[model samples]
Target: MDLSGENFRIMILYDFKSNLTVQKSFVRLRTAFEDEAPCKTAICNCFAEYKSGRINLSNEFRDGRPSTAVNIDGVRRMIETDRHVTYHEIQTSLGIGMN
Candidate 1:
């Protein structure tokens, strides 16, 4: 699937509620998993995974979710790691130049 913009928001919402971070929510869900023993459906899969002690919720979501931020970070890390890279390289590809 094309997981670009809208999908990103969906992921954020899925990961966070109100003001709680995804990590904190997963920790809470993990504790509940031991008590609730919820169903095997996909909607509850993340909670299940946390319950089963299989994987952290964030990691599960991280694997399932598409990350445009990671893509940008990768490019930035590459540029930082390699001095040869330049804004001109990107600009020329887009047919734009610094003023």
Candidate 2:
């Protein structure tokens, strides 16, 4: 079964609504998706959110800065300027934390 994206999430929601335990749901998902299945922690998180009355199935946006704010042009320029520059040096110069 190619239960990769929306179908996978929808299955989780269905299991939640069907009163299936998180462990049971996780097992089913792992059996269906094999290596493509999400981790157990992810299943737990989804079940927790459902129990908390969350129904939306998509990722919600956070208000803080995006995870990746570094500009590609800036990185390219830096690499051009210092061919041997290490990632640590680039991070230090850009004032960005470990990505």
Candidate 3:
């Protein structure tokens, strides 16, 4: 079964309500989701962040490079530079993978 976004919220709620330790939460989630469970490290880190008041039920922005490949100007510039460029060439030049 694929994990739904709501599952994360549920897990976090479970953690909060039960005050389960990270390892216990990990095991609980593993059993709850079976093979579809998220990685143990991710659960541990998320719980740690929650306990530290670093994140809430929702995701928060942190430090990271802003996505640039989808910018209209960037795409326009790439096309203007080489109208004959293949998709592979554009991906290589822009350092962005296609969806």
- Candidate with best lDDT: 2
Please report the TM-score between candidate 3 and the true structure: 0.51
> Best to worst by TM-score, what's the order?
2, 3, 1
Better of 1 and 2 by TM-score: 2
Q: Could you report the Cα RMSD, in angstroms, for every candidate shown?
A: 13.7, 5.7, 7.4
Residue 3's lDDT within candidate 3 is 63
Off by over 4 Å in 2: 59-66, 72-99
Better of 1 and 3 by TM-score: 3
Least accurate 10 contiguous residues by lDDT in model 1: 34-43
- Check candidate 3 and list the clashing pairs: none
Cα deviation of 93 in candidate 1 (Å)? 40
Tens digits of per-residue lDDT for model 3 on 1-99? 676645675676578668888778778887888777767777776776667776555445542365554556776788898898788877787677776
Residue-by-residue lDDT tens digits, candidate 1, 1-99: 233323333343455434455555545544555334222343345544444555433323444545432246655666788779777775564454355
Could you say which candidate leads in TM-score? 2
Ranking by lDDT: 2, 3, 1
- TM-scores for the candidates: 0.21, 0.58, 0.51
Q: What is the alpha-carbon lDDT for the whole of candidate 2?
A: 0.78
For residues 1-99, what per-residue lDDT tens digits would candidate 2 score against the true structure?
455455666788999999999899989988877888878887787788778887666556422367767767877899999899899988888876784
